[model samples]
Target: MSIRGYLQILRPVNALVAGIAVLLGVLVAGGEVTPVLFLLVVAVFCITGAGNAVNDYYDREIDAINRPDRPIPSGAVSIRGAAVYSAVLFLFGIACAAFVHPFCFGIACLNSLLLVAYAARLKGVPLAGNIVVSYLAGSIFLFGGAAAGTDGLLLNLPLAGIVFLPMTAREILKDAEDIEGDREGGARTLPMVTGVLTSCRIAAVLAAGAVLLSLLPVVPWWGWWYLGMIALADLVILYAVASAFRCTTSACVRESGATSMLKTGMFAALGVLLFWALIG
Candidate 1:
């Protein structure tokens, strides 16, 4: 494989973004930013990369059907080789975490196990799989606290939960977009197990829940700016979800757009979160 192709296999951008998010949590939570936390960042990046690799490998056939240009099924990396590569990365990541703190390492171990399980089987269990992926996405924040040798600020966790809740909902909505490929592949995703309409309604409700929960931190502890930004974000999400609710013709299209918009909103809100976490 060419260097570029192999680089794609590593999914460095995805890993780097995730690792930085981890660091951001520690910083925002007012945890000690030490050398060990730095090391933990690298370790988590490697593990995230490994998980991506394994996911790509496992998804070869399905990806070939859905994403023909992907590295593995596209013939850039051998499937067996990718599996071994992923295993090595995961082991190294866990080993580094183990060295930092046993508590953190235990979390790392479980996280790795969950990733493998999700990629292997849980991904086929409808809402269960979505919950697994969504909760794990949120746990990345918690892992940051663990790596920093603390449980993070309580106030910060509430915000984290708010962020995670919608992200989880969006994940399910994204799954709704993939109903055809998943069903064709015999995978049991939410849209496949239940009808697309049901899955979508559930996604909308979860998204609404996220909006309500996000306001919890804004009451007295947070400043006006915090509440305003969160409200703005929530309003955007609600509008998009409302559109989904209104669409009766092609629920899939609305669901797909809504999920994509949710992701965009999530990324955009990082600045608002940083502002509140740092200044307020």
Candidate 2:
């Protein structure tokens, strides 16, 4: 396979974001940057890349219908090649995690397994897949904080909640976007089971909850910088919520770009957290 094909299969941008989230976890928990933290970041990058690659492999049939330009569906990478690449990346990630700390290594192992399971099975289950995805996203902070020590882990709990709620909402919207492919692939997602309107309502509630949780950091140690930035982030999420409410069907949700908007808002919130953690 070509280098570009391999890279495309890895979804490097998503993996890089996950790696950065790990770094933010360390920073927000008051952990210093160290060689160990760097290793943990690399570990997360590789693992996330591996997960994406494996997901591509498992979703090849669905992608053929929903995302024909994807590496596997486009014939940029062979199925076997993608599988091998994923295994290699998973190995490298676990090796890197093993050197960080036992707890971090454990998290890495557990996450790796969950990623595989999600691609193979849980992805088809209504609501279960959404929750798993949310947990995996939030656990990046926990994984980073664990690398620093116990206190770092404790300090990151609230940060994890801030991440979890919106991610769950986004996952629901994503399922809505992919409903046609999911239905053809014999998968039943939340939107498939509940209808897009009901699913969108649930997603809106979750986004609203995340906005509320985003306010809690100011109560602890954050100040005006966090308040202003987080308020902007909240507004972005609220806009996504409004978009969700307006979507009555899968096509409407996809056309509204609500899923991508939610992701933008999540990234904005993450950037705000990272900035404040660095300044403080």
Q: Model 1: how far is 113 from its true place, Å?
A: 0.5
TM-score of 1: 0.88
Question: How many Å off is the CA of 234 in candidate 2?
Answer: 1.2
- Which portions of model 1 miss their true places by more than 4 Å? 148-156, 218-221, 246-251, 254-256
What is the lDDT, from 0 to 100, of the residue 229 in candidate 1?
84
Tens-digit lDDT track of model 2 for 23-120: 88888677888876799889999999999999999999999999999999999999999999999999999999999888899999999999999999
Q: Which residue runs does candidate 2 get wrong by more than 4 Å?
A: 218-220
Query: In each prediction, how many residue pairs overlap at the backbone (N, C-alpha, C within less than 3 A)?
Result: 0, 0
Model 1, C-alpha of 278: deviation from truth (Å)? 3.5
Compute each candidate's TM-score over C-alphas.
0.88, 0.97
